[model samples]
Target chain A: MCRMCDWLGEGQIWYKNPKLHANRMYKLREPGRKPQESLRGNIVGSNLHEALEAKANGDLATFNRLIAEKNAADARKVGAQPIPLNEAIEVIKTLQMPVAAMMCICRKATRAEEETNLNEYSCLALGTGMFKWERWPERYRGGVEFLKPQDACDWLEYWDKRGMMHLIMEEGNDFLGGICNCDYPDCNPIRQRVDYGLDQQLVKGEYICEVDFKRCNGCGECLGRCHFNALKFEVTIDRPSIDPMVCFGCALCQTACNRGAINLVPRSAYPALRNVW
Target chain B: MNVVINPKITVDYERCTTPFDCKRCIRICPPAVFVVYDIESHRGYEVDKKQPGTYKMLPLYRDKCTGCMKCVEVCPVDALTVKMPEEMLT
Candidate 1:
């Protein structure tokens, strides 16, 4: 991954870049049959179905353009039945407006190369939290507000097999208003998680509220930050003891410790996150 | 020729959290064989091809599959699959 360029979602227009291995790279450098292994596993379908699937994969740009041209001949408008491919692109562009407005987008993982169609190489997209809404034009209704954490877990599960899902940091995303789905090219959180190099840029929710033995002001400032009830002042040491399981890694208590007492220690990988396939 | 749900496409009901958010099969398919109801959860349910209930899970969409394996590869919980379709190839 291009560490500095990753901060930008576009990632320096790396169509010819050699590093990307999973998607485009492995397909290119490996011998014909070996490279085609991923593609060959595809199931067959009708012509119309193939055409539509091709567009979603962004594999058939000319076919999509042709369909768009044909739809224009039919003369349709927004919200009309069977929204034209061009309008679908418009809807995707519309969802992207927020990222466009904030300029908050970033590039995470890398692609080997996409064959340019009509001489325009495709710009990849990725997003997390509320940012996912902009990435999928077809999924416009923001219903994540009505969903729970398990719902988010299931949603991620759906994309995991296809290699399309990722997680967002608690600091950058709050589920109440955060997005539920993400695109490979439109999400930063997913991109960073999947990058082959450099894990530092991704935040680990470490450095939480562990009490220092020396400072026992008994002010209970740390207690106030402990929403999970993990911290309670023992009184004798002038510091709080923590209940680890109750501490869901919120990191809020770390912010409350004035004497720089509370510290979060690293542990094994998060149990809930292990299902991140 | 003979069709059985690929053994690899096992659905974990515990993880499914069904009737959940997205009918991802609908979204991912080129021509969606599965009709996902936004309001209902299809978690842990199986499609009986013989009876063929009105609330149907998608068939293989086998006809439309390009052998892409993208579907099989991307399943979060291994809810879908594609295997060696022996008859036609041989």
Candidate 2:
């Protein structure tokens, strides 16, 4: 289990715990007091560039310090972990608050694609954060479209089918605030972790995918769906082998397999992968 | 020891108007180096993007820049410039 599960899991996976999803919609505060600061304020941006510069200059100390600082900041602020489609649906089903579909901030920042319509929004904002989205106009560019529980599940399924990974986002200390449907490069957390080594910002899921060689045809359909580089075509074996260490357990490949040759096994089932996250 | 020099990327905000509306640099860049954000909203409050000069685009990930000049070429207002230092040329 990861550190979050140890802290908030209550003997289970943390995201699966419903307590994190229960956030107070309105807090009583003194007059003239500002609202609780948004999660964006807690983000320590651009430190990765400085860390890279330090590494390039052979200043290992500075590089290590910057990375450690960024890790700490990320732990305190926003963080995400990949989840499979069924688990994401389970999360939505347990939500007591409204689910709103909002334009993906990462896509806007990285691709400059404005998702103004309800059909275009790729991220789901949870709990009280949706109520105060106006605080971050740049992120909530086209506003949000609140969806029913079934509609939200359909949205998740649509993105899952489109090859986007589902990631549960933690806004503050244990508050599950958003579900990001995105891919590598465009998704900030994934890009930061994969490219720049900001590992703490995005953690792996509790499960790992296992491929069934008996049912494999080596069609190479599942290889393209993996953003983690965990899946690769093996010519010698005539089928793709999944590297459990690199898999984030998004299950995009599992869904892509037309023959149902892939299955998700709990990470704890493998002794070596138990602590990999 | 080899000295590493990063490509310098500058966005002339004065010349670039409506960065939200005209995200040519953000869209064209292969590595997605540019990030268009509202500076005023850093403290967490709404800012009107319709208002002129509300949003500013920055090459936040300059390390990822390959010095391809794709952003520079695509920029309609000539607001972006990527220059590799003399050390890198050698």
Give the best candidate by TM-score: 2
Instruction: Using DockQ, give the best candidate's number.
Output: 2
Tens digits of per-residue lDDT for model 2, B4-78: 546777778888867888887787878777887765754444455667798888777766777788888888889
Output the worst ten-in-a-row residue range by lDDT, candidate 2 chain A.
A20-29
Model 1: runs farther than 4 Å from truth? A1-208, A235-238, A268-277, B1-90
lDDT of 1 by residue, A1-277 (tens): 2221232113541111223222332223444422312211232222433443444344556445544443333221110011112222332333331221111122111111112221211221222334444354323322113223333334333433232322221111111112213333333333322321112323222223356667645677656544334567777766578865444343445545577666555323446432211
iRMSD per model? 14.4, 4.0
True contacts preserved, each candidate? 0.00, 0.40
Q: What lDDT does the true structure give each of the candidates?
A: 0.34, 0.80
- Backbone clashes for every candidate come to 37, 0
lDDT of 1: 0.34
- Tens digits of per-residue lDDT, candidate 2, A179-254, equal 8998988998898888767888898888999999999899988989999899999999899999999999999999
In Å, residue A215's CA in model 2 sits off its true spot by 1.2
For candidate 1, lDDT tens digit of each residue in B1-90? 312222122234344333123335444655333332222323323222223222223332233344556655655766666553454345
